[model samples]
Target: MSLNSVLPTRPIQRLSEALANQIAAGEVVERPVSVVKELLENALDSGATEILIAVEEGGEKSIQVTDNGKGIAADQMLLAVSRHATSKITCYQELSAVASLGFRGEALASISSVSRFELISRQDVSANAWRIKSDSGERWSALEPVAGKLGTRVKVDDLFFNTPARKKFLRAPRTEFNHIDELVRRAMLSRMEVAIQLVHNHKTVRQVEAAVTREAQIKRLGRLLGDDFVTQSMHVEFEAQDVKLEGWLALPTFNRSQNDMQYIFVNGRIVRDRLLFHALKQAYADVLYNGRHPAYVLFLSLPFEKVDVNVHPAKYEVRFADSRFVYDFIRRSVRDVVARPITQADAMRESPASVFERPDQHRQGKSVSTSFLAPHKPSPRESQAFFAFQQPVELPLSDVPSINEPLLQAYADGSDTRLASTSNAIPPLGFAKMQLHGVYILAENEQGLVLVDMHAAHERIVYERMKTQWQNQRLIAQPLLVPISLTLDLADMRAWETHQAWLEKLGFELEALGPQQLKVSAVPTLLAKADIAQLIKDVLADWRQHQDSERIESQINARLSTMACHGAVRAHRQLSLAEMNQLLRDMEQTPASSQCNHGRPTWVGLSMKQLDSLFMRGQ
Candidate 1:
């Protein structure tokens, strides 16, 4: 009975077919939801346009899936349930470019081994349908003639019945069903062209129609992500080289408390990739509010060889050949589109003005007004052009005229109607009305009202300008009057040697005194106040771990952000109307100005309809 006596010295032996299959089942069939996922993927791989799923007693009693896809022939019925038998690939080389959703071929065999499985199919070439059932002897029943459509239907009864141990681990019925519901939702989002129906306990639970057009697609997205998400979202399409990304991204104002609403797919297969997630996080880093996650349903398409989806047995993760390239592409593309100015047209797209316009105008043969303000403000051109009224012009910071002159001239020379008419051409942020409590600016655009946090907005503008200036101009190297010699370990010395030129470009005049000694004689002007010794040590450690210089750049940016924050305008400090207007205009022209350095939104919009709804205008 001693522990040492229990050690075995027996020879290795092959496992029995039944026992081996039962073990495989543990990997492919964890619960009712896992079974559903496998079967759904199989159906999709078969080119199914319509799929129906039925479950009873939370799939403890039975689970069935029927698909309108290419079915198997009578001759292939037995082999179809056999392990390692698949039509997806024939050689090892095919693994490099797997395009199908399900290719392992073990899903069917493993699932059948632990449950009472029934399969019925009829191929287009076959004149009669065929059916087969799994017997207790690890063999399939005869392929008897059966009546069925030109597709496949699989029914699994009493899951884990043969393996009572797995059955014991089953969760509560409601808990299991919730997981199945989430899987079905992911499937629906994966392919909008497919119609899906789900039934539970003899009652229809969910139904999604096939989406064929852009409008239909958005409608389907609305059903999955809610009407508010679709209404507040923007359609983005970006293509570069061999990659293409298309989807809907919610505006910065429409953020979520958690990442539950993010759904990203790679080449039509739903995946959870860290590289993609990081890129998305960085894209929204400067625009979204802190502790908030952006909601999106994005799809990225690239060459099959560029990504490897076979990294996981469940195929939920992917590895990119050039991860950094993919990351940068996604980050830059998302940042570009999300930073565009919101226009009156964008507002109308979200909530049309026709809903609020009186019906009497239509009967009277008068054009309905799209403007939110009463009597409607005319386009900026209609007003005597706010400033020269010719074309879009850029006002440089050094050349901007005094605020007093523009404010007095605009009000004295142009009437309110003229100013309102010119709102259309007065940039996206429109014109500032007045300062609010010395912290906020109230402005009027074609859409309605816009409120901006002055300090936060100015902070972002300054930070972006600093970043641009740094990128455009070489770092000024401030040479040390007395050379600072520091000692380094073997690893740090090697890193220094490998990245010396890169370090020099970052304004570090480093020289190797010996294998274990380094002399730092110069540093970047921006980082003159930083702890140069500690900064270099941190940079070297970061470079060794990730083999990239981005860590140093990020560190530099952090210090610059702090500098910009201190230099920005402070709250509770009054600003004249002219200064506020200039800040608004600058915010419009700056990239990623929606938020400040800390991921806090700098502004929010309120449309006329939203304001009207507060007072029950139509009612």
Candidate 2:
């Protein structure tokens, strides 16, 4: 045969059976949370009114899910455990609009292959229930007849036992538990009408009863979120075309250290889409710090065809037809909801304490002295009166005192010193002339006109000062007359343990109450009327999110800065001419005054040339 006579042969396509199954398993079951998610979806798809999940050691050793839904048939038991087999979809067109939680039907097969699985199901009309066990699939067996309810129950043990590598990749029990908890939270939010209960290590971690109405669902969420959140959150609802977005948004002032609190769902499927996340960031742009995330439970409903939910293996991500429209809709909805005034009556009604309360207040009484400066103390009357009101106080910018004339004059003079001193030291080319427009100042440099963003600038200044104290390890601590005990999650306790010395160095006198709790006898003096519990929660949450030590510190610093900035005086309030000059002078002296902490310019300058150009004098 001639060398060129033979035609090119197509490459053979073959992957090892074990490897192929493992790959499939990886796609359907990424982690314990993935397995939980699939199981929950199956229950929901079957029209389950009540579902119970029991896990041992974060679902590492075992996981059992029981649901009061239509059970599987004896003949369908084998098919249920077969790959690519699903009852949720019948025809090819059904794939276009997938309303059910799961359609691939690979979850059961994937899960069973890696773990010892047992499934028992009984239909309402069937006299005999069916049971199947899959151990390596090669060896399958059926359970003897037994009394069973008209539903399905699945038990998975030794997850990833056949795949040691996968099991090795599993995080610590506590970390895994957090993931599982997050999954449950998302599912509960999506299907509020279904009663869901989660048990770990024989302890009930979460229990949500079926909600008859949307308002009841909101109430249940409030109970789960905590009293402070429920009291501070505002209701949000908006609809555009096929999309409807609804949820509760926490006030800008009521923010979390991390983005854990932001829960978003797409067409009843819990997902983590960056578009929605970015929209949230835009909605609370000026209100929150860069690293801090707002607390929200936004639910998005739209036609199935309008969204593609097959983006992620866990189905926690989606692609929208018009992402910008969705983003704008969410941003506007949140902004409008937050802008409206919240009433005390509404807050009280949503308060978690009103729904559930333990007979005994878990308050502790112990005192410890520290060498650091003491925490700021408020009057007993002030402390009592603060919590008495449920509504947040909305103060006008005018309420703040104007800058004194003498101070302004001094600042103006100081500005000259700054310009003269740094003229040679720092390049003038980088400095842009800024023009004050009402309360806003705009500056243009080589990069861009820096918008001084008055509030942000003031906040950065205060934050820098506070951070200096913290960095120098010279924080003042105030001892409490009575110690306060805090019950926290295991992860939080571990975080505290890891940073115990650092926290003490920062003027916090803490003691471990037990494995999952701590007692605080003192706090940093810089914080006025601080809620120790909330502060600890924020710190732990931040620590968990940013595992990098350096990044965590940076996030903490940013948070501190945001707090200082919000508390600082804003512009446009009637400031004395002198005060304005002083603020200007201060701006000239401060390093990086061109922009605020949020990367927005702190001031904008309108040069004489630009002003003349506007008047047709450029020629």
Candidate 3:
């Protein structure tokens, strides 16, 4: 055999500087959007108050970004386009904890390598700006003096021109523009204090001024996310120790089919982290319709050292030192906001007086903010009492009829004049006038007509009450009169054995009967009537599916919801006015009572003007 037969096919060799950069560019610059993201980050890090972007042919022909940021000095202008050179960090310690949006410095080098790049900048009020140009990855022209203001401008033409293979991967102009548009949207949401403008094909498409005020912030949110999102969302804020969360979450009923509208920012850097997304998804579980997603723009702030942002090349992912703690905080905070009960103020847009106040006060003075549970403050014990159904607690309303008493009888005396006299004593849900076809409860508040779905409202009330105690670790467990025996496989047996403590926390007691047998000796007291054997089997199934994440609590919630639905009062069940009013009162105190377990609204409030418009009374 000759020497060639014994040797390798090819010899090892070092890649050239230009070839190495283009290879690195494959990871950093995928398309026009990648270029946009890097340039925008640089502008933001430079303390740019405002930035302008221009694109032609979806950035394939040319792309330009101008920013009112402190420009780069002439001396460092050459180094700015060099790989591994950055002004943001000087040491490994700074690299470990990066605060600026762009720290690695590879963005400029990769971008300039594959395109005809031109950079112009003037620091402060300098007499002239310095310019640099590079047509290929290996060589760059010497810095030359140019006339310019105190800012920076970057231009790239013929992207992927030298690399025909990469150019072939480019999509249609409109499709590429969509990617650039989305990138700008993320930047806009990340820094509300910075003004941004986007122009494509010589037309201004997206532009937003600095959002310095709360109203302006909301306006920008509306402009970017749509007016419907702003109107349908609730303001949310939560802070604990080192973490703070602030954002707007859309109501459960206003969900979308895709997760596209969800935006999460960590320390002003936009990220699409799976952990953060999972926390939010779990928070909205069972509340939003199945296969639907909630719209939100949440900002998370914590110590920079606590989160590692160097995990991904695009910096779109992060590693939290205490991931579980962060997950729980985000989950609980979002859950609380999405589950806030409906108040009278929410039902009435412009009411002058509280309807639930005493009859005299209803006729005079400014309206007090009050919910249907007016005079009674909710107590944890009261919630426990609500589930037991052992005690008939009376609502503290001297002017209102008690549970056993009928509001119809209280308001009626067989004369129109007596009914007119009692109108001033209306409550927030008002006095239930009558049951409409045994399915609807028609009532009247001070502002307008109020309608309630007797069955749906009762279902939500029951589910919320049962969930509240369980969440607070106050779930009452009932020992079975006769323990149900079950046979299980090896996996099921081990699951139950391993998760005994967690099951107990959720108010379940399982015992081993044999190697493949299990005994269900207890269950949550509220779920006592549920099929014990099937419930455990379902729970075990869930335990297997989510064994990795172990969010078994949410799976249990789903089962409880089904039980609550079956146990609630059925539609078309005739009820006295007092029973309907009682449900209304419970609803105000129940979290997430605005929507049923199916994510459908449980009630509707029609203002006087809307009611009048239906009959052409005002028109």
Candidate 4:
């Protein structure tokens, strides 16, 4: 009885070949996007001069790809649908030095297993062409030889026809189309020599003719990204042993809410590598704020053996033999390029105002204004009052509960309490009455004028207060009467799961409504008017774009910057005198009040002597 109880009841058995293939298909050809990527790679590998893509209803009904490449022979038509059949590579030794974008040769087989697949081809020298159709091998046929040009055309219709479960997992038409469009864009960036065209529902969505040079390619990318990006971009180039990195990076001033603008390619293959992205962050660390992604089109070329492209079925990710070396190389190269001063031509290309105008001509008629009046002499008693006001006053820590604990401790311990004590000191008797340059206040004995950058000052005050409330877990949430439902991508859903606790801390209360949907009950107090659905999508999109990195802190910083910018005071709005005075008072109490969160100076002080010199009164 004991021996029988210890033994297993049944032996394990292997899954059926069909079931196992389907599982592999799920990994390799997950959706229409997977099919599009594979077909495009094959076209490029075939040395296609011009490739065209046509889709219907986001490829739910059909996907057709045509390429002007050396087509297959009549005999190879049937074998093309068979697994492990590819002309790109043959031996196991070639696996280490794979040169083509695709080599596994499993895409056509997997796709045919799930969809209605048809292949039509004719070689350049052959007069007759062949066509073959297969539907999960259940029904197969050969069409009559048809006359066609020297190229290949593949049409996949009714994808997932044999697997309703996989079909059910498909997203909406628009969403799926966006994914396909992104795949096409990535491929286009990797291959600048081949002309590419994209059509959806008989309308041309995107088309790129073979560019004359790398510069022309970058200009084409500018057109796709937007004219503003082209104008703001700086060209970058660097070369190392058997490696080269070249592209254009947007100026520090140009940024995006999400990092969608970043593109990286390795060995002529578009890839999403974490090390490359991290190196980009490191290069721009001192220049950009958190959450703001720089725009760039970076292409890296290296020996094929140095990179492993088979890490992911999609082939969009790669592992490098010397990742750190690649990272440092890219970082230093980008930094060097950015640090170089922009030439006159570069400036003109980057800024519209610089175009068609000479700097000297623009400044010709502008004469410096030079007018200053002598400072009004004050009475002895007024001078004494000003002096007395400058004396530091002791502030009781208990009196200001708003003060952070670390700051209070610093003050109580009598360590560098000058700024703190001066902050608490009473304002001079005539402080409110003093005005210089119609904006700044000339304090009695302070070394500098209490100058303020109207927008930046307010931004700091608002940001600090909001950040404090956000950090203390005391967000005042506003519940929604009717909760909103959000549909997201798988990557975003994964991000939500990983950061659910952090989201809750930031005053977001969400629950899973479906496979890729979330139900939101409330939002952060500071973001009451924010579109919760859009915000969730944006956060998720950002998470997906930068999720490959090891540094979650970078993502957190980006979120914080987003929140700060959303809540900060915008420029050009006029403030009343009282509001301006209140802002100054608050700035006096804030640490690091001299700069904004992004490290740009918040205020610039001008002394009386400097102002007199500018007015020609110093003579």
**Model 4 Cα lDDT, one tens digit per residue, 426-445:** 23110222334543433321
lDDT, candidates in the order shown: 0.75, 0.64, 0.77, 0.65
Cα TM-score per model: 0.82, 0.56, 0.80, 0.59
Best by lDDT: 3
Local accuracy of candidate 3 as per-residue lDDT tens digits, 294-330: 7889999999888999999999999998887898899
Model 1, global lDDT: 0.75
Lowest-sum lDDT 10-residue window in model 3: 366-375
Model 2, 423-461: lDDT tens digits are: 223222222234365464443222222334556555444
Candidate 1 residues 44-77, lDDT tens each? 9999999999998888888999998999878887
Each prediction's Cα RMSD? Answer: 9.0, 22.8, 8.2, 17.2
> Which ranking of candidates, highest lDDT first?
3, 1, 4, 2
Give the TM-score ranking, best first.
1, 3, 4, 2
Q: Which candidate is the best by TM-score?
A: 1
Residue 35 C-alpha lDDT in model 3: 94
Worst 10 residues of 2 by lDDT: 365-374
lDDT of residue 204 for candidate 2:
95
Q: Where does model 4 exceed 4 Å of error? A: 1-20, 342-619
Clashes of each: 4, 26, 0, 4
